[model samples]
Target: MFSYNSALMKHKKIHKGEKEFICLQCGKRYRRRIDLAYHVRIHTGEKPFKCLVCGKTFCFKSSLTSHERLHRREKPFGCLECGKNFSQNIHLACHMRIHTGEKPFKCLECGNRFGQSRTLANHMKIHTGEKPFRCLQCGKSFRQTANLSSHMRIHTGEKPFKCLQCGKSFRQRGHLASHVRTHTGEKPFSCLECGKSFSRGSNLARHMQSHRGEKPFKCSHCGKSFCERSKLRTRQQIHPG
Candidate 1:
C-alpha cells in the first residue's frame, strides 16, 4: 500500500493499465509526464546532461551518473556466480547468464537464442543486410555502430587495444583476446572429431574440414580443390595472375 494519497492514485493507474502522458512526435505513451519528456529527447536529438570526466553527453541525469562511474573505474555491482564486477546492475544481470547459460531473447527469423538483447539486435541485421553505420573515409558500411567504429581505426591507424605480455597493440578487442591466449597457451576452441585443440577458432574450423573432406577453396585453372587457402595460393602460382 502507498503511504501518500498521491502515490496511491499513481499506483491505481498501474493496475488500470493507464498511460496519461503521450508523445506527439512518435505516439508513444508513458505513465508519467517526466517519462514522456525523456522520450521527446530522442526525436529532438537533445542530450543536455554531460559527463565532466569524458565530456560525453547523455539524455538523462541517471545515465550521466552511470557514465561517471566508468571514469572512476568504480564497479559497485558484483556478479554472484563468478564474482565479476560491473559498473551497473544491468551489466551484472547480463553476466549471470554466462554461468547459467540462459538465453531469454530468441530471434523470430532464425529461431536462434541469445543471452543479451543487444546481441539479438545485432544478429537481426545479418538477415536484413541493413548497414546503417558507414565509415566516412572508405565508404564502407557496418550493421552495428561498434563495427563501424572499429572499421574507422583502419583509416585512423588507432590501436587502442593493448597487450600486457608483449606491449603489442591491436585495432580490435577480439584481436587482443586472441593475442592473450598465446601468453597463457590457452586453446579454448577444440575439434569434436579428433578432440584436437587450437588457440584460435579459425584454426579449429579449418581442422574440422579435414574430417568432413570439405575443400571450400578451388582453383579455376585445372579445377583442383584444397581445404586450406594457403594450398590454393600455392596452386594458383602455376596459373599466374
Candidate 2:
C-alpha cells in the first residue's frame, strides 16, 4: 500500500508522461504498478472489490469506496454558501461559482463568459452555426443536444415538469420555473428608473423603453413606430389574444 505522499508523487509522474509500468494485454503504459494492475483487470474482466450491502462488484477499491457512499446516503462534498450537498468534489466546486459569480470559462469568438465549461462549449455552437443534434421524428436539427431531447418530448407527449401548486405541467423546466413565480408572486425583475418590479426581464426592458421614449418596434404595414412592441403588434393584428 502506498502512503498519501507517495501516491501523490506517483500521480505526478503521469502528468510528466513517465510510464514505468506497461500492460501485458493491451500494451498500455502506467506510472504506477497499482494502476497497471487495475488496467489488467479490464482485460481479465475481474472485479475483486465487492460491495457488502448491494453486492455490486467494482474493479478498483477507490471505485468501491465511492459506490458505498451512495448506499450510505452520504454527501461528503457540500457548498459553504448555499448549504447544498453534492456527491463529488467537482460538482461542489461548480456550485461555488453561483455564490462567487466567477465565470472562468470564456468564448474565444464573442468574449462571452460562463461559469461552466459545458455552457461555453454550447455558446460556441451559436457562432459556428453547427446544428449537429438532429431529431429523427420531425427531422429538425438543433445546435444543442438538450433542445433535440426537448423536441422529442413533443412527439412523445411527455410533460416532465409539473407544478406542485396548480398541478399544471410544462414541457420545459424554465416554463415550470416561470409558472412557479406566478403562484409565489415573485417579481425579481425591476425597472431602475421607476423602481417598479416585474415578474419577467422582458417586461422590465419594455418598461424602460417607455422612460427613454425609444420606439424600436415598427409596423411593417404602415411604417409606424411604438415605444412598446405590444402596441405595434396589436395594431398589426399580429399579437396573439
Candidate 3:
C-alpha cells in the first residue's frame, strides 16, 4: 500500500490493467503518459538527456546514467561467489550461472539447453537453416557475422591473433590458443576415465572414443568406422577399387 493517494491511484491502474496512453506511430499502449513520451522518442530521434562530461546524448535519463558509469569506472554490482564486478546488476546475475551451471534458456526445436539467451537464439537458426550473414568475396554464407568476418580474413590475409613467444600468427583466436599450447605444453583437457590429458578438447574427444570402443566416424566409401574423424579422413584418401 502506498502512503500517497497519487501513488496508490497509479498502482490501481496496474491492477485494473489500464493502458490509457496509446502511441499513434505503432499503436503500442502504456499506462503512464511519461512511458508513452519515452516510446515516442524512438521514432522522433529525440535525445534530450545529455552527459555533462562526454556530451554523449541518450534517449532516456536511465540510459544516460548507465553511460556515465563507463567514464567513472564504477562497478557497484559485485558477484558474491566469484568476486567479479559488473557495472550492471543484470550482468552480475548472469555471471552467477557459471558457478550454478544453470541453463535457463531451452530450445523447443531440439530440447537443447543454453546458459545464454543469445546462444539459444543462434542455435534456433540451425533448425531453420538460416545463414543471414554472407561474404561478398567468395559468396560464402555463415550463421553468425563473426564467422563471416573470420572468413573474410582468408581473402585479405589478415591474422589479428599473434603469438608473442614465436611471432606466429593465426586467423582465428582458437587456432592461436591451440598454437600457444605447443609452446607452454599445457594439456588442459583430461579424461576422467584414463586421466590422459590433451592440448585440445577435440583431441580429448577423439581419445575418449578409444575407451568407449565406439567408432562413430564411418567412411563414406566403405561401411567401416575408424572411431575418429581424422582417421576416417585418412582412410577416405586411399580408394580401394
In every candidate, how many clashes are there?
0, 0, 0
lDDT for model 3, please: 0.92
- List TM-scores for all candidates, in order: 0.74, 0.68, 0.73
Model 3 clash tally, residue pairs: 0
Off by over 4 Å in 2: 1-31, 35-73, 211-216, 237-241
- Best candidate, lDDT-wise? 1
- Candidate 1 residue spans exceeding 4 A from truth: 1-61, 162-168, 180-184, 234-241
lDDT tens readout by residue for model 3, 1-241? 6899999998999999999999999999999999999999999999999999989999999888878888999998999897989888778878888889999999998899988898898899999999999999889899998899999999999999999999999999999999999999999999999899999999998899899999999987877898888888899889776
| Predicted candidate 2, C-alpha RMSD | 5.8
Q: Give the per-residue lDDT of model 2 (tens digit) for 1-241.
A: 5679977887788789999899888799988787898899999999999999989999999888888888888899988887899776777988899999999998989899999999998899999998999999879999998899888989999999999999999999988987899999999998879899988877888889889989998988878999987788788995434
**Candidate 2 total steric clashes:** 0
- Cα lDDT tens digits for candidate 1, 36-105: 9999999999999998877999998989998999999999999877788999889998999999999999
Write down the lDDT of every candidate, Cα atoms only.
0.93, 0.89, 0.92
Where does the lowest 10-residue lDDT sum fall in candidate 1? 79-88
